[model samples]
Target: MYQCEHGGVVRLKLAVDPDLGPLAAELSSLARGAGLDAVGITGAEPFGSTRRHLEQRKAAGLHGGMHFTYGDPARSTDPDRALPGARALVVGARSYRRAAPAPPRGNGVYGQVARYSWSDHYGPLRDGLGVVARHLEANGWQARVLVDDNAMVDREAAHRAGLGWYGKNTALLLPGKGSWFVLGSVVTDAPLPPTTASAAGGCGSCARCLPACPTGALVEPGVLDARRCLAWLLQAPGTFPIDLRPALGGRIYGCDDCQEVCPPNRTEDRRHPPPPAGDEDEPWVELVRLLERTDAELLAHLGRWYIPRRQPRYLRRNALVALGNVGDGGDGRVVRALVDGLAAGDPLLRAHAVWAAARLGRGDLVAGLAASETDPEVRTELAAAGLTG
Candidate 1:
């Protein structure tokens, strides 16, 4: 309690009790037992450095129409913007690093998904963070859980919490462990002990991740141009860019080349046994089946992904490109898909179909399509293929 003298009258100001007394250890212990691999705390001040970086990159056109925290850096960086009167953030990290699954058993054209998308890693991560948040709530503090959410800059919080340092690839690298973790946090009003200093440099001059990009997406250390990023390109709606289409290879979802080539990741994997697999998890999806899935079916399967406008055609668009990259040029299904897409009503599908068919040396099927196609976009696509009919 404090006394304030005003006009010769003494008034007492009662101090609010900080409920987190002696509870930090319990929070960390509960988080670890709840399945989180790394847990730490930090003050919930606005992430100034991160906000400036976001604003600067966005102004430079490096954001490439991509908007997450890039949408509004000021709001995203401030914990108060997410929750009023927030004082501390309890950050959590869970490893999604798993040995690559065995290649497809049968003869089927398939597209590889990034290891992170192999399953719902965020679900378990959220559960662990929930335990931490509830623990704070069970006491007398107001707490909120955020994971893979735009509410806060999770990596900055994690870094401040001494969880790890940012690798050249812009991923957080755990001390001995690699950058194979999914991050999240619990924002609370409790006055928890915050980590003093961030982890020191782990990537001493290793530039392997820089040249590892097949599409040259990594413009520099710790900076990425989303336009050139294959992961973002796949999620971006509209036609896949012509020049980068071939570089896509058989990647249907996210790209993991940078992480795969990271020396730390390779070393970390060798030390642990492969993570178990399940029928629900898919490291790769059959190209033909993906193209054939209906909107409902696509949602049922890939809804967790960041699909463009929640439409199935976008997935079909990506599958079509992957098919052109790896599908047998003469496979009946491949031929049929190309022909069907060429004859379809959607100009986006029709345009990509023209490219895929011609790419597969099925120039013969395009002649009839060129004659029947009336959409100016489809005509332009055919003209590009040298099909005048």
Candidate 2:
């Protein structure tokens, strides 16, 4: 049984054409030559399981207003939505996991960023997928390259392609390689042969990932409540939830706790060689510097990510929380950050600053802020934190 993207299960009849074997072989070679770590093919069937999961979770409010695949599951789960005549999907994986890089020298307060965000993994993955798409085009088949695209469910494509299995964390884990790889695919009208087999999963009784979450975002095996997820919340607009602030800790963007605790990922991490530039290449952002940058400067640095409506305040919002958690209240730099946050234009930023100021136990700072605070929200923050004069 092969999965098609549009709410239907279809078998990719291998006997449709004998030449598919050679074509598949050539495509895989092209992908690897172009720098992809893994490549495999599967039918463009709608990922029924993925669709069901998304629908169920959204209905339960577990999606937390997340629209990615949930905005319209039927479209995202069906490969055909990406291309009308799609017959097969060629999934590719690229490794973004690098050896831990040391923090840049001289920092007041440092916050952690997920490994995937440290560099643009999708750029290389897209380039590699393009190589195969060109090959298919040369062979007279319509091919569309999709990586990090909202129109497709890439992990389902990879799973059906035999490249990996679903780990408890909902990540597609490549056997022996773990969940450190980024996945993408080429959906085409060509009826390529599906891979003979998928990588058998090694996860047995292990459930370490569930408990590894700081906020228990992973509610059950492979199921996540996006409302509680720090990664999504960071990119999510508006105020950072007060209850979850402590769990957010020093993470400015993305949370890798589940993957960090996975046995397979850890084992492979130990054996694999570190990234070329070491930890220095990793973009471990300095918390205090966030508020210092102008909108243009901040955009130039992190334009790659999905900021809340492309606004810089969301980035500053996350940094404010990080600064509150890891920053030294005694440091003059931290004092300036708190002060600047109080003067910010956005109510969201102002509200978050209130939380951060309270977290740092900057009572004197908050007391001074109380008198001048006009925003009802900020006033509530001051009173709640006992900063009321």
**Candidate 2 per-residue lDDT over residues 143-173, each given as its tens digit:** 9999888888888888888898888888889
Clashes of each: 0, 11
TM-score of each: 0.93, 0.93
Residue range with the least summed lDDT across 10 consecutive positions in model 1:
9-18
Model 1 stretches with alpha carbons more than 4 Å out: 1-21, 198-201
Whole-model lDDT values for every prediction = 0.85, 0.85
TM-score of 1: 0.93
Clashes of 1: 0
